[model samples]
Target chain A: MAKGLDIGTMNIICSEREEEDVVFTQQRNAFLELDSSDLTETMLDSAKVLYIERDERIYVLGEDAFKFATIFGKDARRPMRYGIISPKEKDAIPMIKLIVERVLGEPGYRNEVLCISSPGEPIDLDMNPLYHKKMMEALARRMAYETHVIDEGLGVIYSELSDYNFTGLGISMGAGLTNVTLAYLATPVMSFSIGRGGDWIDEQVSITTGLPKEHVCATKEKGFKLGLEVEYGSADGALSIYYDALMTYVIKNLNRKLAEVTPPKVEFPVALAGGSTLPDGFLKMFERKLREAELQIDISKIRLAKEPLYSVARGCLIAARTHEGEEIGSGGETEEGAG
Target chain B: MDNTSSPGILQRGALIYYVGSVTFAAGIALLAVGTAFITISRIHYGSEPEKIILSVISTGVGTTLILTGINMMMKQTRYGYYIVGASAFISLLALLIFTSNYPHNWFYPLISYVLTLYIAGFLALLGNAFANVILWMIEGKPEAVVGREREIKIYTDEEIERDIEEATRKSIELSASELKFKEPGVEEVKLGKTFRETRGNITKVKDDIGEAKSLRKTINPGERMKSGSVEVESVSRNLGEILRKGAVQKGRFGKIKEEIKDEMKKFYSSIRVTRNR
Candidate 1:
């Protein structure tokens, strides 16, 4: 049983690992982060597994419920899913039980409330009205309090503060989605994703090289950065394809949004956050590509989070604190009529 | 979803190679059938031009097969290249034997023999190249997608209050004389020493990770940790510092208002169901 409730925010990165050949889109650089990876893993880790596919990629999400002969854990088992319901109702039982245990920490937790957060835009723009609420409610059953969102641009705020105001683009990269938060006025103006983040990168690298995803990741860890010619002809040039494809969105879709956002007072910069952005120089590559496309954005102004991975979660904490009537430090100009 | 073709230079090249090899093979097979028909019946398969076309058809079939094989080979098709190569060689050898068998048929046989030999050689090379191309295309197993989701829990109302309280204290840079120590649940007691000054000395009191092991150790004496006597100031001296720094002011007009409102909602929401109970 876990006592202290661990809270975090995840800017879901739609890496190559999560999507197939096709890259997912970054929703207005909206954040799709979560409080913990544990809750997601629960529905996915155990027995029954299910997935969803939208926009050419497959998503293995909702884990099935299972008869809990008594199962629990603090560390991850493997391969948690998120899309929809698992094979059987019972498949999700074990995971749900673990969520319960983690929040309540043993028998005294039958009704301890749990609060979670989501990427700002997706939850708001979900075509399915109940899609998000249902997902949050499903989570609520395991814990007590369930909050889907902390506040818009919450994570970006923490990231900007960490980076001394977007000297660079702050990317909250994750699996299934990637959120880009661009801060110029020491606050986020807008963020968008080019899809094909870490997961897709991993998957493409493995498939193209005949190597396992884990091996590729290990190699990436060893500084065998993608976009370079590998031992076998760049495995059909995954990185080249990835960058060209993804950058198009950054150029076409996101650039347009950036143009539209007329910042009134402050000049924010670019910074990156999230696990996907944790890789060394991902920000630089993105910046370079954007520049090459003649967007002519200044790369020197880019800022990387001191701890790229934890920025989003910490931002959620900031969000939580703000909700408590506590003060959150300031940076960017506030949008008029924004609730 | 960004709907764009994966069609890049290499993909386009591969597609062109595929189409070429397939058409080449189909054409050669037709040519081979034409040759077989004429060879079996000694009759002109068609008019003079038609007979030539028939012969060309057979030659084309052989050429297509050879080309397809070679393309596969270029793509690193281990087996396809070998098979194509072998078949092309066999066809060449067969053409050689047949042409040679018609000894002394003069110029026509010689020309025919040379043509057959050329077809065989070309086909063999084509097959080998195609095979290589196909093999190279074998990137073996495709990679799998790895999904990641991180979850963090929102604090209950009481926990939020505690965090806010602690954060407020930490925010202030206080003097040594202004510090005090407060004890459990209620009441503030001043202890003229600053927690900051004693924090290095306060190492024995582990930060409240609330671990079972720590709880066990605290209960036991061998660990030499603080017992019931451990205390810190309840009223943080940073209160005045907050006013000076204006964190409150910044948080209010800037981002903190939204953040506070959000957290307060979560806190109350957590308390909501429990109150119902």
Candidate 2:
């Protein structure tokens, strides 16, 4: 079976269709480093946690790294920053490669089809998405997979807007960047990104509230909700305020960009997907912001993805399946037999 | 080519001509005076020794001036007339002064000076006129004009129509050849058809997948997370509990702090941190 991968800033998720179900495997795309010693190595060996040993030192990886960082009062480091490989991290590529390998595992067959979701080029940052796309494709190819890169926002459309003929706007509120795609009849007409997302909100809230970034991130992930009105006295409240600001900025830019194009004469539903959109009442806040901005397009509805965090991976799986089917058909094989 | 427009060259030539005329006039006056001096010396002094020397000197001076005047009249040298003119004028003055004060008294000297001056002036004028004539002949020729206008040729209607028809025919032929050159080959036709079909198939498949997604209910991430059994759930819960307890137990800050510390110890033991750089 083909696999779909979402190499997100926060997590690396691999999805595969097993029978009638979609199964996902994920690894935290983060790490923490510590001075190496005999005792430390023994402790790490005994704990059996995911780690990499390099240059006479050890790197604690995955979700456990953050736990260790909190105890040590040190910040957990991410291999990815702002949705691409962190340029400052010396071991970013190697660490990401290890995580991707663990999450995707070995291909079931040689040259197995794999569709990877890649973020659109950022409009507000000098980051090159092409390098990231090529790197991920190279990684997947190394694992014996025939890889394809899909736009992160378009992947959201493939996952959530199948009923709309893929003609709506898809916004993936990821941790490092908010990817926006406007599609018409399954074709992407415009795709761009703003370099602000969950991480930015957490960072702003952390700074404003004088709390550790880890604590802020933990608070946000632990079922925090943003309402029409926020309580300014609490950390969650601070986070909510920032979330609103981010939504407002995104909407304003979206409207400005949309104004430049001649939109098709069809109503489009705005679909929000990604880890940042997991907060409660996020759909309502987004809808309110869009209405307040008075965008030019006819938005039918604003709905959240059933599973925001896995939508990109699921969309990638869908694309991979379709691609596999096409390959089979072109090779003179029966589609039903291939399925 | 117009003499009036280029005054510099013409002005120099005219001045030279005037100088030559003056030289010629002065030479004739000197020759006349020398002849009169010799005739008076012979008639009145009977060729006395002192008078003979004076007559010979006067004749030699007159002969030199006449030769200079003839040379200045030629156009062989540039500014040659100025030399001749100055010499002739000086000699005429000298002769007039010498004859006026010496053996010949005021009457003979006065008569000789007046006749020589008048004759010199007249000959200079005549030479100047001839110089001008020569200059005009050399400079006023029509063929010497530097720039000349060319005649424009006009075509007949028949010729113009024939040229237009020829150009149109050539252009039509070129267009026909270009069209033939750009005609699609068999391979190109097949390639284009395959490309279109592939594009259509891709669109169809995308639509099919989108339709399929729309029919499904909202995907529950909680269910998927539970199935994956990721370590984030435990970490998030533990961290959340500590933060929540810390916020709630503000009055027992010390106890909450100890509890947090204890919890961190337990969590850190299960994980490992290292510096890999």
Top candidate on TM-score is: 2
Best by lDDT: 2
Off by over 4 Å in 2: A326-339, B1-277
| Candidate 1 per-residue lDDT over residues B53-166, each given as its tens digit | 446546645555546543442332324435555755555565555445433443575667666776666756654554433433453322100111224487678658856854
- TM-score of each predicted structure versus truth: 0.36, 0.54
Please give the DockQ score of every candidate, comma-separated: 0.00, 0.01
lDDT of 1 by residue, A1-339 (tens): 111111222122210111112111111111111223444435433423332222332223211111120123121122222212222333242333233232223222454222233433332122321233244345444344323342223354443544342233555555434565555433445544444345566677687768666455445545545344434455335544554465465456556555644444544455556555554556667767666665334444556665565455445433333232111111121111211
Q: List the residue pairs that clash in candidate 2.
A: A33-B274, A34-B274, A34-B275, A162-B210, A306-B219
Query: Best by DockQ, which number?
Result: 2
Question: What tens digits encode model 2's per-residue C-alpha lDDT throughout B1-277?
Answer: 1234233122223444455567667767767877898777563455564675467456645655655555444442233345446545655565555555554554675657755754564465345435544554566643212122324589778658856955784476445432211212322111111211111000001122333323221221121111113433565577778789889878988987887776665554433221112
lDDT of each: 0.39, 0.70
Is model 1 an incorrect, acceptable, medium or high docking prediction? incorrect
Residue A8 shift from truth in candidate 2, angstroms: 0.8
In model 1, what is the error at residue A295, expressed in angstroms? 4.7
